[model samples]
Target: MVTMTSPAETAPTPRLLALRDAVREIERHAADRGWDGEVTASVFALVRTTDALSATPDLAGELPETALAEAASDPEHLTSIEQDGLPEATTLEELLAQLAWPEQVDGAAVVVERLMVPPEAEQGLPQDPEEAMAALMAHPDRTDVRLAAGVLRTGESWCAVRSRSHDTDDEVAGSPEAVPGLVEALRATFR
Candidate 1:
């Protein structure tokens, strides 16, 4: 006998579920920092749970017991390590272009926040970068949004997005390609 399963029935593999959890955790940490912030762009390395624990034994004790238990039983689990002191870059694209990860890094993720206006409000914008940003920030309908995207070396990917207006755990939305460009860029780092 043969069997077939629908896409919804097998959409999330163990590894992909683990990837989603890791991405959400990163997004939550960003939220906890409060919205009184700059337009920041940050990158993190997603190492295997076991590898991360072994690499920082002292840090393991600080992790929640539930997390430690999950890490021990699930080979697909991942731990996020923030990458700091990145070289200065004028744009997020430029920053991502400079990244190249070691073979041991199982995946990568990034969180970027921006202030934006509706498409109709973008017309007749100032040509200068500083002036344009100021205009956007001052627009009556402007919104603040944060995007978190992650990709594994094996090709699985996930994305989560939260808007300042609806900034709650239940309000956050996610999809495999919520931020396609960012996901592609992170995947390139593993190439």
Candidate 2:
């Protein structure tokens, strides 16, 4: 009788090798820049999430439901992105410039929002999250805030769909009252 091999024992396919190489490049870049532990952890989380989503496209639909709901209930997760010392703006800008894939965009945005926006919102505005979020929404450069908002909104939308199907309340409530001003700012990107 022929012996059967388990899938886990099989060598990584070519695609997996490429992905591993890509991740290694990212790690080397992060190491070169002396990224903080939190930043590294967040990057790994994003990589895993992306890999999972790619392997099972159907899971994409289900991910948002649970993730968004969790984020809504625990905004701290969004705020803690900076727990790993924020990389220098130039370093972050460089990294962003290097990211070419759509999946990378999604992952990068998640990390950026968690690291940059919350601290900005905290230091620049009121202590209360609602008030701070409002101020961020209204700020002249609300793109950062909006990006974060979009992530939050997207996550909440996903969470609602997957975990708590019965909950009708919008998971991402409390939009800043100055959203129109923010929208105007977004339109005038040249300014």
Who wins the TM-score comparison? 1
lDDT of 2 by residue, 1-191 (tens): 11122466665443333232333333333334432334422222223344345566685576557543543453232211112433444453343333333332222222222123334545657888798768776765433211111121122111001012211222322221212332232222212
Candidate 2 Cα lDDT to native: 0.31
RMSD, each candidate, Å?
4.7, 18.5
Candidate 1, lDDT over the whole model: 0.85
Model 2 regions more than 4 Å off: 1-90, 102-108, 112-191
As a whole number from 0 to 100, the lDDT of residue 77 in candidate 1 is: 89
lDDT of each: 0.85, 0.31
Top candidate by lDDT? 1
Model 1: per-residue lDDT, tens digit, 32-97? 887856747889999887887787798787778878899989988898889988978998888998
